[model samples]
Every structure is written in structure tokens, then in C-alpha cells.
Target: MMLPARGGPEPCGGNHGSGRDHSPARAMREPTAMTASPQPPSPQPPPSANPAATPARAAPPIRIAIIGTGTIAHTQHVPVIRAHAGFELVAGVNPTPVPWWAEATGGLKLFSSMDSLIRSGMSVDAVAICTPPATHYALAAQGLAAGWHVMLEKPPTPILSQAMDLHRLACAAGRTLMTSWHAACAPAIDPARQILASGGVRGMRVTWRENVRKWHPGADWFWKPGGHGVFDAGINALSIACAVMGEPLFVTGATLDIPAGAATPCTAQVRWATPSLPDGMEGIFDWTHRGIEVWDIAWTLGNGRRLLLSQGGGGLSLDGVAVTLRGTHEYECVYSRFERLVHDGASDIDYRPVALVEDILSAGQRRPADPSFRILP
Candidate 1:
């Protein structure tokens, strides 16, 4: 499959030139004390003799505990949390010894388990669960029950029922429970959404192919039943697509390519329908390409305008011209929104993407894995 061209230079990070304009606008000239002869100053109300009131103190940053110091926790979650002013990384929970980088970056107070972390009397207002998909439910549920706001990494749980249960737990505890669909917050997503909303979509296609060995390396969990195989990363594309063209109403058909002796599919082809799209509009997700990585989604509008979002939303082109989007700092954006969700006492848990994954798993036809294909060590 041909990947859509990214069309321009790589999106840069950091808010280098961005800063609030704090300088006051030019002061308006004091109106010339013209005619009106300042009517005899109306008697001014007498000032209270009590001491002046003090300003309210600012709330302290939300202390966050990082659960599972794995690849994502190290690469994205931890750095973003450390840089964001609204949050503080106070501790880390993982069975493995705390990674060197985690220790170097202020030596997070480490614990082998969630129970131990909670029992340690460490102050934490929220928890960022970065563990594998199968473990998300248990950890998130425990956090919510312990009165901590929870931010779960993508594919919130292995199945839809568990995700819904977490939502209920969060609601009962009156805490924020957010499923971080990082791709949904990409730079180009909002623009694509607006384009689709205004100009009806005729069709949509997604190509989310990448070499598992390159990205996941020796991760054995990926071949397990709940590991989600290709959909593990493909779901990011699905989430972005859903954000652009409303949620898929149903999975029309699907095919799973599972390796021999493996419980999960290494590659999957899924077709889904959405009322927002025209009748017979087919959306394709292909995750088996080997050479170059392709992470893109394209849409055909009713008026023949072709829109493409590629590089997992780092680049966008509408009818061939590069569409300028805000800087691409998806993880940063995720944490920023998470902070607001925590303060507002509201939850933003959307199960549409995961529900779609579950649908495919339940209905897709399974094929034997290629005999020559070797599982990455």
C-alpha cells in the first residue's frame, strides 16, 4: 500500500516563540476633564475599618503516581508529566527495578505494587496507568476505589465491559477517569473533524501498518489473547478516524491473521459503518505492511475534496496543499486536558474506539499465521 505523502517539514516541538502577552495594551488617554464640572462628588461610601482580605491561595499541583515504568511510561508519560506544571510525578509502581532513567530523573519513590504504594502513605492525587492493556482494569479500579483520579493509557482495558465498569467506578467515587487516546488529540485531528463536519464525507481509508519488531521488540505480551496484536497500535488510527468521522456504528466484516500457536492476530483487516458517512462508505484498516511504516487516514468529501492526515497526525494535506496545524505535542496535550479534567471533577471516558476493537475480535474470521513468519524475540 502506498502511504500518503507527509507533504512538508517535520512538525517541531516545544513552545519556543509562544508566550502570553502580559504587557498591558497602550493605556487610553485620560479623558480631558471636560465640561460637566464634576458634579459635587457624591458622598463616597465609608470604607470598612476591618483588615483587608487576603487573596485565595493557589491549589498545589496534582501529585501523580506513574504505574508501570515500561516503554510508554518512560518515553511519553513521565516526560510529559514532569514538564507539565499542573502535575507532579511523586512515585512509580512496577515489579521491575526502577529503570535507570526513572531514577536519574529525580529518583521516583518506587514500589513493587499498587497496594504497597498506597500503604506507604505517599501522597498522590492521581494515577497514570501505563501498563499493558490486560492490566489496565485492575490497576485503574484500584486507584479509583482508593480515591485517586485515574488516567489510563490507550485501549483502556482488554474488553468493553471492563471499560464500562471503570467508568461506573469513577462515577461512584466522584473522581476523574480518562482514557488517553493520544492520537485523538493530534494537531490535525480538530481540523479534520471540522472539515468532515462541514463537508460530508463520502468515504474513509486508514493504513496503520508498521513492523512490530521495530517498535515492540521482544514484547511477548503482544502475542497473547488480550494483547490486541495489530489493533494495539492500529486502534490509535481508529481513534483518530472516529474523532474525524463520527464513531463507527458497527463492524461490517473483519479478518484476523494470527500466527501459528499465537492467541492474538498479528494483522487484521476490519470494515466498519457509520451513519455519519454515506451509505456503502467503507473504512479499511490494514496493519501488515513490512518495509516502510504507514500511519495515515484519508477522506473523500462529497464535493471531491481529498483530505489526508498522515504521520499519525503530524502532517496534514487538504486537496494536496499542506494544511497548517498547531504544533504536534500529543502527549503534552493529553496531560493538559487531564489536568483540567481532574480540577473540574468530571470524567471523559469514551469507549467507542475500544468497543470497535472488541467488535472486531468477536466477529472477525481467524486465519492461520504464515508458516515462514517468525515471531520477534
Candidate 2:
């Protein structure tokens, strides 16, 4: 059984000035599994899979238009596309000129907007929307309506209703829509899921903290109303949590610590429950830290078996012994999956993460900002 949204359908209060309705809809239940936690040594997948062994495809390489040439697009999306055999980087859409790195790597046509790209007659089979969360729904809707497959960044949209709308739009347009959860595609995640599928879960503890200054730097949108504050990072953890424990019953309780001048929370503590585990199968989601960074999820099973995934799903341990797994290439995996989905005409739009966020927004309580926490810039 899945937990229901505590606060009926209502937008979680924040500084969402984008004019889009941020109201959440009813919670959607997903498949079940145990939560994540630390555990002892266990079996692991090979260091890496042979790319040659990937299912052979006779279709031509997918021509892709990359929207938003920001940090993530530059660091992960572009590089992966350049290396993948199944995709072609046909065009790039951004208001600013293409970045030096992107320009340096030749073979990309640039456009000022998605409209210009489409108007330019660029033959794009799919588009990867890497823009801010607030713009996702519009951009994705446009892409799907234009009959192009879409891969949206995490937290699919600002609100649960928008995400559902996109799913429905994609269905109507017969286009594939995938919401990318990079962390859940980590190498260690498969093994962790396998363990949970084989046993009963006791509880889970998630510690996902990072320095915004170090990662986001002067990205002001991060502190805006729809920016999702700490949730920008916290949602990744929540994605993995839901992947392991299934759809959350509801966000039992939460506390958001907003910075003085920021429109979003800088730190958050959230408790969620799922029906798959016992009443005591508690899960904690925390995102408030400075200096060193940490991303870990540990699960305790009913039989006392412990499992842990650290380094944001880059490392895995079972029964206290490290389990060496494949090198981390989450973006590459994402593209590979997209290739298959497009060829097979399938859509994988998981709304559990959006539902979880909506549940938190609807039911979680807001606390005063931490006096010491200051928003830079």
C-alpha cells in the first residue's frame, strides 16, 4: 500500500513566481522495494559491461537537439552524446552563444531558441531538456507536440500535475518521454535494488548534503521560488529512495530552513513512510551541510542484513565489505536507455519523485531560516 498525500491537492508554499501552477495532485503509488541503508559485503556486477555487447541496433543514430547548455549539459550530457554511437549531436539551443568547450568540440549547429532550431529545419529526432525546472513543462510540451522524443532533467516539472500532463501529452503525440534521475542510474543502484527485492526491509537512512557555493556557485535561480532550494539536490536522493522503497505513503513530517533573502529552503529534514515496510520502517531525507560533501543511503533489513550505497551510488558495500562495481557513467547509461526506448517506441516517465516532492510540499511544515546560513550573491 502507498501512503496518501497528507494535505489534499495544494501547491507547496514557496516563491514560485514563474506563473505556473505549482499545485500538486494526488499521490501516485509505484512498485515496492525495501529502503536503502548500510550493509555487509555482497555480490557485485562486473567492473563494466562491454559496449560491443550492448544489443545491436540497425536503426540510424538518433539526431538530438540539446536544450540548455549549462553546467550539467556541458559536463555530462554533451560529452556522453559525443561518445555514444546511438546518438548524433545535431543542434544546440541556448540564448547565449555556444560555450567555448561546446564550440571547440566541432560539429554542432547552434540556435537561439527551440523555435529557431525547429524553424531552421534541423532534423532532430529527440531533444534533451536541460533547462531550469520552471521551464521544463513548456519546453517538453513543445518538444512532444513537435513529435520529438524528450528526456527531461529530474523533478520533471515544478508540480505533479504538470508532470502528469506531460505524460499524457507524450502519449497523445506518440513520443517517448523520459525523466532522467541520474543518481538512480548509478552503477551501485542495481545491486542495491537486487538485495532489497530478495529480503524484508527494516528502515532507511539517507544523508545527502553538499555545498551550494561549491556546486552551484552564483546560480541565483537556485534560491528562487520554484528553484526548489535544497530540494534541487534533495530530490536526487528522494528519487533513489523511492526507487528502492517504492512509492512513499506520504511525507510524515518535514522542516525547511530557508535563508534570509532566499525564496527557497537552504536546508531540509523530511521523514517519509511506505506501506511495504513495517510501521517502524522509517526513512529520513536530509540536505543541509557545508565544507565536505556526503551522499549516502543505508538500509537495514529485517534479518539484520545491511546494505549501503555511498558516493552518490558510485560505491557499494554489503556486510561491511566494499563491493567493487562498474565505473560510474550514469549519463551514458541514460543515453543508452533512451536509445532503446526511442527505437522501441516506449515511454518511461516515473512520477513517483514528483509525487514525493508534492507530498512534502503539501504536508511538510516550514521553519524559520537558519540565522547563520547566508545566501551568497
TM-scores, all candidates, are 0.82, 0.83
Q: Which residue runs of candidate 1 sit more than 4 Å off their true CA positions?
A: 1-57, 102-104, 247-249, 276-288
TM-score of predicted model 1? 0.82
RMSD of 2: 8.6
Top lDDT hit: 1
* lDDT per residue as tens, model 1, 107-191: 6678999999999988899999999888999999999989999999988887887987887688788898887877776666667
Model 1 pairs whose backbones collide: none
Q: How high is the CA lDDT of each candidate model?
A: 0.70, 0.69
